[model samples]
Target: MDASSAGEGFTVALASGETVTTRQILLATGMVDELPETVGVRERWGTGVHHCPYCHGWELRDGHIGILAPGGEPFAELRVTLLRGWSSNLTLLTDGSASLDRPARQRLEALGARIDERRLRAYEDGPDGGYRVCFEDGEELPVAGLFVAPSQHQRSGLAETLGCGLDTAEPNPAPFVVIDSTSGETTVSGVYAAGDLTGPAQSVILAAAGGARAAYFMNHALAAADAQAALTAAGLPAGSDGD
Candidate 1:
């Protein structure tokens, strides 16, 4: 599918030779998480490997949990701290990526979390329905679950094609779509956005709330536009007159 500007509205072209036109557009396109290319990771993503602690922490509580601290993760230290709450037996797998400083190493140790800098080789099934992490150094660690800090990106490129700006801030694995906090309006007027594509709060409840808020403002904007069109068609001033 392809979309572009068409006069005062926008036009969307579908692959099946269909087109849609609208005066306003709300982009609820979400994000995509890119995991490491380690063996056995891709196949067991949602079932065994996860990215969010709040979403999956309770299920794996009090068990041996491993945090796969991949390189370039902006909040590596913070992630370890959060996951430690869910499982006292926590291990931070550096995978030959994290080089912890003295203080950082000491902090993790204080939290009773072990730091493993071994290069990860692959993952195999453990005896108890868990995962066995194999290292290149011939060492293995078994855990009930593994939390990965994945690099994320927009699921669709249509937003950029339509000239929506992105927020380039630290700690965000990927740049998110920039929108007016009060109105959910994108940098491009008449175009709006909501949900995970807008910010770091990637929860179902928050995404739904965002969509509702954007829809409220979108309805008002469309109503105003229609009123102006009616006035112009009747050969009257655009400004409101006594009704």
Candidate 2:
């Protein structure tokens, strides 16, 4: 089903025909992983195909792992090279996209990783319960795990529908909401954004900071409203601070 957006507020019409609504919307939606257009890649997600080595590498320690270079030098090569600490059996699959510089290639070679210059054709579940990656050059490699560099985009369509802007960058270039540094307030009023939706290299600690900032602003707004009500009840100008 297609996600629709309208004025006042957006509604996600579920497949079961249900609608949810709210007055003040906060889009803390995270990111979407855009996979490479390759065969068998989609079928093995999480099980064999992965994006963040930091998230999945530990489980694959001391196993034969393959790193597929989709794009970007910083994230594609550098990140996989860093994963060498987890496993001595790492293979770099170039897939005929980008190549490494001298320093980068040396580092990869030093880690005892081999490079596959052949273009990736497809991936299939290995008979031994791992993965079999086939290249266009008729070369096949068996790996316990396969890592890919997926392009990440903000997962919230609601943010974009409400006129929230985006910031695109290298490594994993994608769109994300723009917000104030201190308040987590988006360009759209009454709408606050946080987490990876705001595109700020958000880890757990950073996400907590964003939530606190938004809470602070919302609390201040509510407090000001309460103060105004008290002033009105006491027959004083709301603008006056009892001076």
Candidate 3:
């Protein structure tokens, strides 16, 4: 289906070519993981490559783990720190770019996590579907699981079609859709966004929370507007402007 649009009201084009117009639009398209172009990374993504350390850390605990992120891009140190709880052998691979700040580097090293700043040559899958991270220096790290924070974008192009503004956090320079802190309204009037597409607190729980918050405010607005319209239709004063 085509995305919603802005004008007198929100218009969303359906797959059958019909259009549904409404007073408000909620852009809950979510976010998509922009995986690195590492050869094995794409092939072994769901199996061994993961972005959230908490998601697959426990399963690969006590084994080698690698934190892979794009080179030259600023990433969160907290990510590496969190994985330390899962495994004693953790390597933060910069993948060839000089992104880690000295303090962040110090913190990770202090946590007993090795910092591997070598350029990633490629990711080779093991017979068991695990990975072997090959670096330019010909060093190979046998890892059971790899944690990476790849760039992310709105899952669908619908948000852009709606003409909404976006915001981005560190490590990723791309902007995502912007929304109100309380009501979750978008930069565009009558349009709103929530979930990962709006901010970085990602998870099923957080996504549901954002959805409920946006729904509450949207319902309130619709109720008030519809009530006023009904009063006017019935030839009533509609409570007058100043009331």
Candidate 4:
């Protein structure tokens, strides 16, 4: 559906080119990950390479887990910190740009996590479904799986096209659609956002719950509006509908 920007409320143009207007809208467009342009990464996305540690950590626990560090600053620190709990043999490849302050480094070292400030060259499949992360200096670290925090972008630009405000996803520079933390309402009135398009806590279960809440709030608002209109027609004040 084509989101319209020139009206009082939300409007969508369907495939048949017919415009449908509505009082409220819920945008669950989701997001897309901007992964590293390396061989074997895209091909083995869900298998060897993954995004969320909490989601895939238990499955790959006790294996030689590698954290492909690429994002700048404390993001890498946070990522490596979280991943260390999932595996004892944890290695954080700094990708040549991740700089952990003295205290952060000490904390990582204390946790038995190794910090390798090597530039990543490429990825290769190792024996028995393992992976070898090749560095520019010709060193390789073998691991069962890799976890990375990739930059995320909106899958569809409809939110921006409809004049929705966006906010930066912290620890990284990616901008997500601006939404109320409680109700998921966008800056533009009558338009709401949910799921990964709103924040970093992206998962099927969370998205589903977010969608349900957005729908609930939208429905409540619609019912209130209807009640108000009916009260106005009956020559009563808006809040008098409670009677």
Candidate 5:
């Protein structure tokens, strides 16, 4: 079965070009943000342009920073406010997006970060080997680092096709496979999910823990099946028969 897409189902492209079927599938495909068409943004993704502050903030601490805004979705202002801790020379660019709320506005002001109302046209290499963000209004800003909140799209389309639901009540409503916190069991029998596909805020340690938990459950499940078959072959009850 060619269940390459993310989400919680199987896609089988038959070799004879006829038909295919799948019983259970787990969509563990993660999400990715498509960067803006800006020139330097793509090239500097890991070096200077970044998204997750927790992942890339520490390295750029105390450096001049710029944040591109007008995000498609609503996130807590705390996201940018938190970045203020990393650099006092931070600037927020409002590339023609909605206005911030009063409280958010006050917080941004208190952080000593300047807000750029002009639209961002492109970015290029700066003289200092940093970045030069050009505005549509022909103004330019130089910064040692840049951050932008790009819209997130699920990498797994198979999960959505199979109707795997997401935890919409929480923030971010992209479809995700349901799993037992302890066993990693999905709604569909025998399917499991782990890592970033489950939800955000997962670190390497957390992902490793999730994988371990799933493996532990799978091992026990296989052991139980083996014991059942052994007892059945011996002409005994498959489960505990008051032994």
Candidate 6:
């Protein structure tokens, strides 16, 4: 699908070879999660593998948990620290991707978490339950669950094509479309955004809330614009209330 600015509004060219116009656009395009190259990670996503601590931590509480800290992820240390609260039997699998600083090591040691720097081979269902962590050096570890921080990106390039600004600041490993915090309005006046496309937190509840808010604002904008158009057509001066 192709989207572009058309006069005061926007136009969308659908894949079915139909062109559609709109007065305003709400972009709930969402995001794409890019997981690691491990064999079983993709197949086991959601069912066995997860990314958020708050979302999946409670279920695996007090059980053996392994966190895959891929190389060059700036938030690796932070993820390890956060996961420690949910399970005392925590292991940091670096997969030979990163070196821990002295302070970072001390922090993990303080949390009584074990560090496993072996390269990962695959993930599999254990004989009993949970996941089997396979290493390249011919070893395996069993964990109740596994956590991974996958890189995220916009699912559709229409946001960028529509000239919406992106938030490229730190702490956000990936860039998200910039939107007004209150209204979810994008840099483009008639364009708005919500959900994973606007922020890093991937919670469904937050996405729903953002969409609701953007819709509220969009409704007001649309109503006012329609009223103004009607008044102008009647040869009357439009007031603040569009009367």
Best by lDDT: 6
Q: What does candidate 3's lDDT look like per residue over 102-201, in tens digits?
A: 8867777898878777888898876575678998889888889888777776788877787888666553445678888998998888888888888766
Q: What is the TM-score of each candidate against the true structure?
A: 0.89, 0.73, 0.80, 0.86, 0.79, 0.93
- Alpha-carbon RMSD, each predicted model: 2.8, 4.9, 3.7, 2.8, 4.5, 2.0
After superposition, the stretches of candidate 6 with alpha carbons farther than 4 Å from their true spots are 234-237, 241-243
Q: How do the residues 105-210 of candidate 2 rate in per-residue lDDT, one tens digit apiece? A: 7766887778776788899898778888898888789998888877777675777777777766543356778888877888876577888777736576677788
Q: List the lowest-lDDT window of 10 residues for candidate 1.
A: 70-79
TM-score of 2: 0.73
The worst-scoring run of ten residues by lDDT in candidate 6 lies at 70-79
Which 10-residue window of candidate 3 scores lowest in summed lDDT? 69-78
Q: Model-by-model lDDT, in order?
A: 0.85, 0.74, 0.78, 0.80, 0.69, 0.87
Candidate 6 local lDDT, 7-82, one digit each (tens): 9999999999999999899999998999988889999998689899988989889989888876525566677778
Top candidate by TM-score: 6
Pairs clashing in candidate 3? 72-97, 166-176, 167-176
Pairs of colliding residues, candidate 6: none
lDDT value for model 5: 0.69
> lDDT tens digits, residues 1-243, model 1?
777889998999878999999898999989999888889888889878988888899989999988888652446677777888888998888788676778878887897878888899997778878988899999899889888888789998988999999987986778899999988999999899999999877889889999999999998888877888899899988885322
Tens-place lDDT digits, model 4, residues 132-180? 9998999888999988788778898889888899886355457788887
- For TM-score, candidate 2 versus 4, the one ahead is 4
User: Tens digit of lDDT per residue, candidate 5, span 67-180?
Assistant: 876632254255567788888888787766646776776777787877777777887788867778888888888888888776666676655555555565556544456678
